[model samples]
Target: MAHLELTGLCKAYGAICIADRMSLSVPEAQVLGIIGPNGAGKSSLFNMISGDVQPDAGTISISGRDTTGLPSRRLAKLGVGRTYQIPRPFGGMTVFENLLVAARFAGGLGASDARKKCGEVLEATELSHLTDETAGGLRLLDRKRLELSRALVTDPELLLLDEIAGGLTDAECISLVAFIGELNKAGITILWIEHVLHALIEVAHRVIAVNAGQILADGSAEDVMASKDVREIYLGSAEALA
Candidate 1:
């Protein structure tokens, strides 16, 4: 059975239909990428899955257990960890402290366990050198790394990443892509929403494209990019932006 399933997912706010009965399934430990133009309900989809927003209609299941409409805290405890498009580290805290807090609050880890987990996550994310740096002092790339570290501290089975590579340079993006690929190879299911087409193509086995609240294409990276609807909606126009 698929590890995560979104069946007939729909959401609306007043007259705006943000997700129109979108459905998809992701098997265990696979990497799925989401691509679309701006305002394509990409972030909204993450919000729904992470339980920040409840759908008007649909069923969300993780490991075959229904999680639709569950609170974000509940979902996190269920091993669904997510990162936002914009990194939101605690400015007053040290890098290590920020991850320690995430581990304690989101993963419900004990003091010693949280500290050890935070250390591991920082090392994995290559932030060990900046452990004592103030979160407010981090540059863009380090901030992004910190975001991923925070998510990883929870030891999630499923990771949801939103634009983690958006502001990175080519070299940094390649490094981040390699890091994510390594994570996937280690058996973590990943659902990534990114505007960086090349990066997605590098890491995702399958790509899903959403437009105006509906899925327009889904298949292998090459196949989805080659789809008529995807080309017409965003792929063809994306070169200038990419």
Candidate 2:
């Protein structure tokens, strides 16, 4: 059975359709990469899957059990952890505190386990030294790190990352991508929407290109990037990919 599956998903706002009978599936422990244009509905799709948004019509199944329209908190219990394109850590809480909250509530861990998890997460995200600093005081990259940390502390079996590599330096991107590879290797299923194709390609086992909420292409990274439809969606940037 697919680890995550969406069938006949339909969503729209006024005349704008973000999902048009879209269907997709991700196998266990596989990394799936998604690429699309600015308004191609990539983030919206993420929202729907992560329960930030609900589809007007569809079925979302995890491990063969229907889970459509479940709230983000509920999804969290089902082993789904998601990061937003924009980080939204609790501004008043310290970096470590924020993670502890996620570990306790979202991860459903006991106090001792939550503390240990948050400590490991802080170190993993390179925020160990800033554990006591309020989240709002951090720089953009640190906020991004915290965003990812919040998700990781949940110990999700399926991880959804949205533009997590967008603002990082080249070196930082490499490190983050390598870390993601480690997560997948550790048996986490990953669905990542990335504008940074180079970084995504490093870890994604399969690639899908979305255009106007439709799957424009689905195949190996090289094949998907070479798809005529995908190339047109990317426009002149195809030359840059050469």
Candidate 3:
């Protein structure tokens, strides 16, 4: 069965339809990459699936169960985890504390289980040495890592990452890409919306481009980016892909 599936999904803001009878299915452990220009409704589509936005029509299913309109927290308990385009860690809390909260509330773990989960996550994310540091004090990379680490606390089967590599240095983006690949190798199904083309192409098994709330192209990363329609959607197409 598909890990996540959307059938005839529809959403809109007044006359601007964001999803027009869209149907897609994501199989387990597949790293699907989404590429599109800003305002192409990529994030909106994610919001609807993650339950931050309700669709005007259609069904969303996870593991063969109808989950349309389920709230974000409820989805969290069902093994759906996502990270925002921006890191929103609790500034005053320590790294461990932030993760502990996610493990307890998001993962629904007991006290001991929560602590253990936090410890394991911190180490896995390579933030163990900074476990006691205040989140606000972290530099950009560590803060981003914390955001990713918190999402993992829920032990997500389907992970939604929205521009997780945005605003990072080239070297940092490379590192993050490798880490994401490792997560996928360990069995997490990833649906990533990313603008960082080079980094995305390195790891995604398949890529699709969305334009005006519809799929413009779908194929291997290079093939999709090479499509004439996709190029036209991106300003200075060749440069955009580069």
Candidate 2: which pairs clash? none
Q: For residues 178-238, write the lDDT of model 3, one tens digit per residue.
A: 9999999999999999988888999999998988888888889989977989887886666
Where does candidate 3 stray beyond 4 Å? Answer: 236-242
RMSD of 2: 1.9
Cα lDDT tens digits for candidate 1, 1-242: 99899999999888888899999999999999999989899999999999999999999999999999899999998999999888888989999999998899888999999999999888888999999999999998899889899999988899999999988889989899999999999899999999888999999989999998999998999999888788778845656545
For residue 239, model 2's alpha carbon misses the true position, in angstroms, by 11
Off by over 4 Å in 1: 235-242
Any idea what lDDT model 3 has?
0.89
- Per-residue lDDT tens digits for candidate 2, residues 128-186, read 99999999999888998999899999999999998989878899999999999999999
1 against 2, candidate with superior TM-score = 2
For candidate 3, what is the total of clashing residue pairs? Answer: 0
Rank list by lDDT:
1, 2, 3
Ranking by TM-score: 2, 1, 3
Query: In model 3, how large is the Cα lDDT of residue 184?
Result: 99
